[model samples]
Target: MKLKKLSAQCLLALGSLLALGAAQAQERVTAAIPGVVNAGTPIEFIQDGFKGTEGPIAAPDGAVLFTENNNARIIRIAPDNTTSVFLDNTNGANALAYSPEGELVAVQTIEPRVGVILPQGNARTLAVKVDDSLGFGRPNDLVVDKKGFVYFTDSGANGAVKPDPTKTAAPAVYRISPEYVIERIAKDITRPNGITLSPDEKTLYVANTAGEHIYAFDIDAKGKVGPRREFAHLEGLRQTENGPSSGADGLVVDAEGRLYVASNTGIQVFSAKGEPLGTIALPKQPQNLAFGGPGKKYLYVVGRGAVYRIPTLTAGYAGRAK
Candidate 1:
């Protein structure tokens, strides 16, 4: 009788362990955002152990290419989950976008410039210093319009580093014309991080890493942007040891004009009209994200030295490679 009692207790303990494991596995899957993400769809952990992963963009062949900035190399993840080095010695490139001319443009932070880095000899500087004297603080992210204009954000220096006002330009957004003319578009943002344009090219959106809201501007027909306005309030902002920050890092749009923002809370989805849809919480805080895979159905996210993807119900903006 004593042996049977001991056996029953062991079985009960084993069952409890199995149940806890199942619950934890379910927690890995994000909460569905209705039309955006389906319920019970797991946020698949693709790979990890990267150094400063950022600036993910889809290739023409459906592979996702991202910058391992600290490693100074671009890594490509194929559809079959194979990984390969796409480029090296990237000058600390953080964000990437494809020009209308099919060239890869990046915002390099090492030398702090925006330029093309691919096709070997075709590489050339697009914009370096904001002017002859004042250099950019730190070029963080960029996006190219159909007319070949590039819009990027300079996030400025972090708190640890003191920047001289005479040399380092304040945090701002800039536009590089097709003729390679650099224009300062907005300079009032506290810390401009990620940048993107609307699918129709009518609006420009920027994420403020230190602010509580995502900002937007109206784009004119001539590829100029107007006054800045608060588009959507971000979630998961808190008082960190460094100070208060929303942790809004990367921004992207879908085919239907919905905005997907990588924030401290997760991927916060907003409607075209700037209504809050729902947030998809991930296991790790996502610093950047872009749509990739067949038909741009997968949202590839990178942050904190890891990569993750989620099969989404809708697709990314088909007109652009971002």
Candidate 2:
């Protein structure tokens, strides 16, 4: 995860900034008109004994895949409600996404590796800590576009004994193009964590966890990100008994262009214009979310050693059936 760099003024907005601090609500606002208050309901709890689960992505075939970072595995919850291990020995896999051809791309936080997991559970290094030319501190989260290009973050927190306190990589974001070209997209994020593409796949959102903000980028046809811009900032995120001791984790987009963020305060919904519209309360802090189920109207949340869901009024941006 990237660390937040803040001036005293920014801290006043977030309230308190900690890697795992609990959040206090400034105030509660009502959901906008035509929004469903009970659009979501709790679903099954897939308890696989994970110390923590960070990212959950919906597979094209309808299964929801997630990372068990503590256990070093990727688990899957089938549409039929069965649970299975998708891949083991993933070595600190934090976030995952599907490429255009359905290949699973994961950001490995351990040694800051990028891996492609085969459909059969075999994992191989797509990009490793090759040399000084690449940009990856400790890959934490990732998202893939309609093309095979992979955009991931590096946070560098696995069990490796190699210690580089002065690592200049400095919690940056990067993109691995279809041709395997690596490019440093941004460097100023204060602990960048979760990431997602827009419903139209024209924009990219990267959540800066410790900084209590999300950065938006314009995605060109070449899959390269333009200069970074601030999208939303949740100034003071804190932890609760439910999950995420503090900070933001993952993000998912809805069909209507609303962005849903999983953070210490549950799931916050924001309009395309960056207005805070409403929220889905969760028993635990949500690390990640995905829209699934029959009509793609269900939002699946992975948090606090469990997997839960609530229904939504709109369809999921990534799971529409043809």
Candidate 3:
């Protein structure tokens, strides 16, 4: 069943990518913002031609911290459009978000641990090993909420690994509570990648890179996830040989509760009610994104060797999270 669906989507993608390219050239406008936000806002290339960039998150200092996935370095993009390496020798780090204490919380993929970059430029391990019995393979992306609880995805979507039950790891979502307890919040999805909480922090949006769906789950007071429902599917997106083949990679939520998801169709914007609002098309397939810059009105997107900026009317859910 899954293969049949993927085959169909791939066929559609093969036929439509030419049209997609033509459309991108025409608009370069590329993004469709509906339901509330306007779509005419210009999307530009602030920085391009780097190593594989991913996991963009806003820092408290009006700059954006995005990971260079291929090089395992976290680069900071200042408001002035200058880029610098913030942290190096980072074990293939991916996603990053600021904690309540203003520390940079990051997911170090190869080490499979979460670390906090101190204000003085040091890294501290928050959570190591996923569990005693099962562990994380690739700690892909992460999001930190108000009370300092951490939610992240252990997505084994990068390479085709020959499965060894002794070393086999399942892709899932795990949470490190405020009290520093680690627990698996979800394991039903194929490879849980991008994650974000609503402004109210009651709903959690998770993108499955291996599968064609994005799932949303209700968050309890204690921070545990309730039952999940299909939030959205990769309607016009197709698969790739490596990953993100299902379309949804890194996703973010705005203060208006809109979800900005990265896929083969650029960034798909969904309203608070999970309605398909529109797509912010880009020249390259984006790996991750975040809302940063001075007013948090700037959308920073990272992809194969480049970073982009898209100005929007809505702000990010960073300082607005309850």
Best-to-worst TM-score order: 1, 3, 2
Candidate 2 global TM-score? 0.78
Ranking by lDDT: 1, 3, 2
- Looking at model 3, which ten-residue stretch has the lowest summed lDDT? 157-166
TM-score of each: 0.89, 0.78, 0.84
Worst 10 residues of 2 by lDDT: 19-28
lDDT of 1 by residue, 182-280 (tens): 889889998999899889989999999998889999988766579999999987888877567899999999999999999999999999888999998
Q: What is the lDDT of residue 56 in candidate 1?
A: 98
Candidate 1 Cα RMSD (Å)? 5.0
Model 2 misplaced stretches (Cα beyond 4 Å):
1-49, 120-123, 130-135, 156-163, 166-168, 221-224, 239-246, 319-322
Which pairs clash (backbone N, Cα, C closer than 3 Å) in model 1?
none
Number of the top TM-score candidate: 1
Total backbone collisions for each predicted model: 0, 23, 2
Model 3 global lDDT (CA atoms, 0 to 1): 0.77
Error in Å for residue 305 of model 1: 0.5
